[model samples]
Target chain A: MENNLCIAGFGGQGVMTFGKLLATAVCDNTDYNVTFFPSYGAEQRGGTANCYLIISDREIGTPMSDILDDLVVLNQPSYDKFVSKLKMGGRLFVNSSIVKPTSDRSDIQIISVPATDIVVGMGNIKVLNIFMLGVYIGYTEIVPSESIWKSIMEKMAGKPSLVELNKNAFEQGIELGRSQK
Target chain B: MAKVLMKGCEAIAEAAVRAGCRFFAGYPITPQNEIPEYFSKRMPEVGGAFVQGESEVASVNMVYGAAAGGTRAMTSSSSPGISLKSEGISYAAAARIPMVYVNVCRGGPGVGVIQPAQTDYLQATKASGNGGFRMRVFAPATVQEAVNMTYKAFDYADMDRNPVLILSDGVVGTMMEPVELPPMKSDDEIERIKESKKKISCIGHPLGERVWIKPGVWDTIMWENINKDAEKLYESWADQAEWESFMTDDAEVIVTGYGIAGRIARSAVEIARGQGLKVGLIRPKTVYPFPYKAYEMIDYSKVKAILDVEMSIPALFLEDVKAAVKERCPISTYLRSGGNLVSREEMVSRIKKLASR
Candidate 1:
């Protein structure tokens, strides 16, 4: 089985970090082959930054895929730009706090989470991406929750307070996603 | 060592460090900045020197100086930056200084898009500089292969006493993958490797014992002999030609590429196989030597057409492919240029069309 995902947003929305965390979690814990590729260059200077992550039971081919199984957009521009690339019955995870996206396509599923608002309520707005990650993982069950948490801790190792806030944000987001399902 | 996730540029840098590279000098450029960035932090830890030169020209010259002094040295840059370093590379080649440099290629004839491209084939293999000097060039398809090739490139440079090139593209430079890094060469091992080159190195020998090494020979006959000796060295590299032949034993149509293009083509070959097509792949690991023997070994009686896939406008690598095939079968090309990658779907469809024909 193979899963191709594209995460896109403005420069500081943690699009690349979101992909990197999930890729790292999958690569470190499982024997599955994974590749993480970022859209670099001018798109990174306050423009729409995006990244591609591929996870496969077998070896992965090209890291850049025209069709995606999942797409997480943190803004409306990213949603508008990338929604057409999603495959039929693919999932779209949107940060509803910043983007109110309406799509004409009916074949794909759209899941909206107010990740920014939720993280702000949790007292740290910076964990919005982590919260979104939790929702994606909780809904998809693509990988173990513990693995994502472990990766988060490893990433936020030196900052104890940030780690705690991120942990709460992630767990709460996971509950919200599970409640929906 | 356990597999760790690393960006391709960072992995190449670490591999070079483990390979006992003690001196690194480079200038920053898009798509390949991580190479010099990683080396800047890494070299100091290994008790090596890292110089962020004022320009590509200066950076490559610094590497030339380090290599001449028997230090394992390296430099890296993208397309236009590499063009700037060509003269330095040629000088090193003429002086027979052992060093490794990488061209993490960007799309360009001149300062094209900062996206990945395979546009430097002829420049790397044919005219690196004015001297018509040749170097062993390795084009790895994956991050692991990038690490392995970079680690081995230093050895090849030392063995041949010539500069070596790692021709990578933007995708391979910026993408991240899980890699098993090579073991670090201990300090003593690094010292011994340096010491092995002391006799020929310009590290200030005692008076009257110095062997002056220069990149130029003024005497006409002496230069001719030097060129002749370089020709022999280039000829000997045929044995070092490396390639991967997949499912080619009875393939009716053969697909071939180098670097990331080769890697994608391999996937396309597998996809074609799943659909029950008689397609296979020939991936060149060493582009400079061109792996002509691999093409010559193709069973012409069974093969119908040869498909050459690359990310160059007019297909620079096609020349080598043509020379290898030698008119035994018609050759077709599937090309995507200007930083666009050749997708697996396109290649699979092309392979199907060729197999049907």
Candidate 2:
């Protein structure tokens, strides 16, 4: 199976980091072929940032694709810009706290999570992306929870305290995602 | 060996380190900024040196001096930055210094968009420097190939005493993927590698016996013989050039491309074949050696036409493909530029149309 995903948001939303964690987890924990391509330079300063990730059982032809099997939009502009590119039966996960997706498509699946509120309630807004990743894993199960947990630990190597905070956030996200049908 | 997931630029830098690259000097440019960035941290850890030069010209000259001193040296830049280094590159070629350089090309005739494009094919292969010096240019379609080719580039450079170019675009340089990284050379191995260059290097020799003293450039005949010998070395690479042919055994129409464009074209050919069209692909891995012989392997009687695909407006690779085919069959081009990729659907449609006729 091939999963072509686009995660987009403002540069401060950690879109690139979220994508990297997912790609690296797949690389470190599975035999799956994965690629992550990010938008950087001037775009990273204040403009919208996005990352295209492809996880496949076969060799990936290219890292960039206009057709997304899944799209995660953290802000309204990202939702507006990328909503049109989602495949008919594709899945879209949005941040309900900041983005109110206006797309009227019934064929695709939409899962809205209050990720910002979830992380803010946990007293650490920096763990927002990690929490969103938990929701993604909960819905798709494309990557195992154990793999992501281990990846999170490895990624946050130096700061032991932040690791615990992110783990808590991720678990909450998974719980929220599991409740959404 | 175990594999690690890394971006293409970081992997290329790490691979060069493993190949005993002890010195690196480069200016920062988008898409390739990571090469020098990675080396800045990595070089120190490996007991090597990294220098962020003031400009591309200074960076390449620093590499020229390092490589002349018998260290495995490297530099990297994008299109406009590479243009600035051209003169220094020519001096390296004229001095016969073995070094490695990377051009993570972006869309450009000038300071173009900081996105992937193969517009520099002619600049890299046909005219890398002002003296018409030809480097053995490797264009990798994937990150793994990028790693493997980069690890091997230093050897090719030292063996031939010429600059070796890794011709990658921003897409390949910036993309992340899994790679089986090669083993790092130990400190002793690095010293040995440096010591192995004693015969041609002026590092240890007295000033009286140095290359500058013996052949100090007032002699026009010596320069003529040097150019003649350089031409001969370039000609010998024809025997070692590399290319890949896919589904060509029964193909009636052939598609050709290089680098990432070639990778995209292969997918289009596969899709066309699934739809009962006899399409094949010929992808040249080495752009300089040009792999002209690969075209001769095609069965001209059955093949209908050749389609050249690229992400350049004027289609730079098409020139070499035409030169190789030498009018054996008709040729067509599908091109895109300014950060646009030629879509697989577009190529498949073109191939189907060609097959029907």
Reference-based TM-score of each model: 0.98, 0.96
What is the model-wide C-alpha lDDT for candidate 2? Answer: 0.89
The segments of candidate 2 whose C-alpha lies over 4 angstroms from its true place after superposition are B206-208, B213-216
By summed lDDT, the worst window of 10 consecutive residues in model 1 chain B runs over: B209-218
Kindly list the per-residue Cα lDDT of model 1 for residues B262-351, writing each as its tens digit: 998988998899999998899999999888999988999998899999999988999999898889999999999888999888998888
| Deviation (Å) of B116 in candidate 1 | 0.6
Q: What lDDT tens digits, residue by residue, belong to model 2 across residues B283-331?
A: 9999989899899899999888889999999888998898999998999
The native-contact fraction of candidate 2 is 0.61
Q: Give the root-mean-square deviation of each candidate in angstroms.
A: 1.3, 1.7
Model 1 TM-score is 0.98
